[model samples]
Target: MDLEKPPAQQPPDGCLVVAIRVPVRIVMLVVVLPVRMAWDALVVAGRFLDDAVLRPVGRGLLWFGRAVFVWPFVALWRWVLVPAGRALAWLGHVLVAVPCGWLYRYVLTPIGHAIAWVGRGIAAGLAWVYARVLTPVGHGIMWLLKGLGAVLAAGGVGVAWLVRYLLVVPATWLYEWLLAPVGRALVWCVNGLVWAVRMIVTGIGTALYWTCRILFVLPALALWRWLLVPVGHALAVVGREIGAALGHAWRVAGHISRAVGRFLATLFRWIFVEPVRWAYARVLTPVGHAVRDAVLRPVGEALRAAGRATRQALASARDSARQARADFRRMLFGEPRQPRATVRREPAAADTRTLGSSTTALTKD
Candidate 1:
């Protein structure tokens, strides 16, 4: 199975892009080479400065800052602030926390309980009054209001009957007999007038719309279609080509700069790094190996031998001292007694059982 993906095909470039690309690349090369070189130079100088000067200075500054600022603050926090904080915590626990806890437990709690009991008693009294006294009073008042409402409702019905016959019935008859036909005729005439006015207004509006279209909108549309669109399209094409050319030029300039950088690096290696490497490999390595063999190795071997002899002497002295201490103890307290081994009650090896023999009472052999 072929797991590799096929390469994507790029679209073909237009003649405008092709024509602009070379000149833009040339110009970009001229412009970018100096800038790239200056940037590389600054980078090299920065690295060299950091390695040779800045690192040591920064380390010194760090030590100074630690000594002057950090260490003092750390010591103050450790020795002074921590102790002060502990003392303040103890004081607060004794003076504020203990007192507050006592007040809450012994004073406030009992007071709150008493207040709650009193409030409950007052609430109970109020509830008793409401249930016993106010409830019956409210019920009686509501009954009386209901009876009054019934009587007032009967009177309202009588007044409603009188109003219907004296005012409402006459007004209804007048409206039906006298006013209805006149209102209907007036409504018909008004509807006709409104329709005629609407038709006139609609015609006027349609004429105005057509006039506006001819005077303003059509010419503006024609100008946009015939003149502005083509000009805009051309400008867009030119802008696109310029932008593409700039991008292509920038990429080409980058490639050229990279090649220049590599060439310079190679040149530097040839001029400086190669000779140093050669000197270290061809000249210094043999000299260093000779010096090690002639001077360092023998000195190291002599030092090791001396160290072994000293260790042997120290061991023998330590053994002697230990033996003397043991003799001194023997002189003072006599020799230590040796431990005795216990005797075994089993039979000797000749009486032992073999694989073909049995020693049991039932199968003795």
Candidate 2:
């Protein structure tokens, strides 16, 4: 009846003991068994799902992930790689730039300078050759030109002298020869003319003396006697006749002068006074009135009438022209034709006949 000692009842028949001696194995078994079973079931289920559906889904997800993340990463790399590479290249260039510049200065610049120097030297050599060697040739050419100019000048001088001698000597000879003959002939003709003039003067003087003696002296002597006898009688008769003729001429001249003067006076009075009176009576007053009445009034009326008529005619003409143009246009191009009606109608009828024939043929076929 000592319950305490009752042989520590043999720990539930299948209970295990572990190292800790506290039925840990049994506790572990009891507790972990269900978890392990559940884990196993889960693992089996996961395996089945993976085989059936999850694997394919995972693969699709992997592909999707690759497409979404890896492709974009690759695309980003492709897109940015050039600039990145350029940056790297620029960095490389920056790193190498100084050396390259130094290399160019030291190596390439020397070569370029050497080539330029060589070219300059060659050009200088050519120029020197041209200046030194060809200078003598140029001098020769100048000398030749000078010699040619001298020869030409000499020839020109010679030709000028020859021309002067030929032309002037010949012309002087011809002029002297021709003028000598002309001078001699003119002198001879002048001498002859003088002789003839002297002869003519002497003959004229002698003949004049003889003619005067015969015509004037002899007649004068003869007439002197005759005149002496008849002088008294002739003087008396001439005196009487002269007196009578003077008296008659004086009377006739006086009468003619009086008549002419009277006629002129009368004509003058008639011309001036009669015309003045006639103009005053017939023309001036009546003309003033007639001008006032007929000319000014009629001109004013005619001007007004002309203005009105012009305006009316212009308006009428404008309207008539508009109407005529309209009518002409209607006749020419409107629906109702005029002179060309038959011409247009013939063609239109022919076209209609042709259309009808075509239509009839089409219907028949």
Tens-place lDDT per residue, model 2, 77-137, is: 8889877998999998888987899999999999999999999999999999999999989
The root-mean-square deviation over C-alpha atoms between each candidate and the true structure, in angstroms, is 9.2, 75.4
Error of 1 at 91 (Å): 2.5
Candidate 2 deviant stretches above 4 angstroms = 1-272, 275-283, 294-296, 303-311, 330-365
lDDT of 1 at 272: 100
lDDT of each: 0.89, 0.77
- How do the predictions measure up, each by TM-score? 0.58, 0.22
Candidate 1, residues 273-363, lDDT tens digits: the string is: 9999999999999999999999999999999999999999999999999999999999999999989987756546888756555654557
List the pairs of residues colliding in candidate 2: none
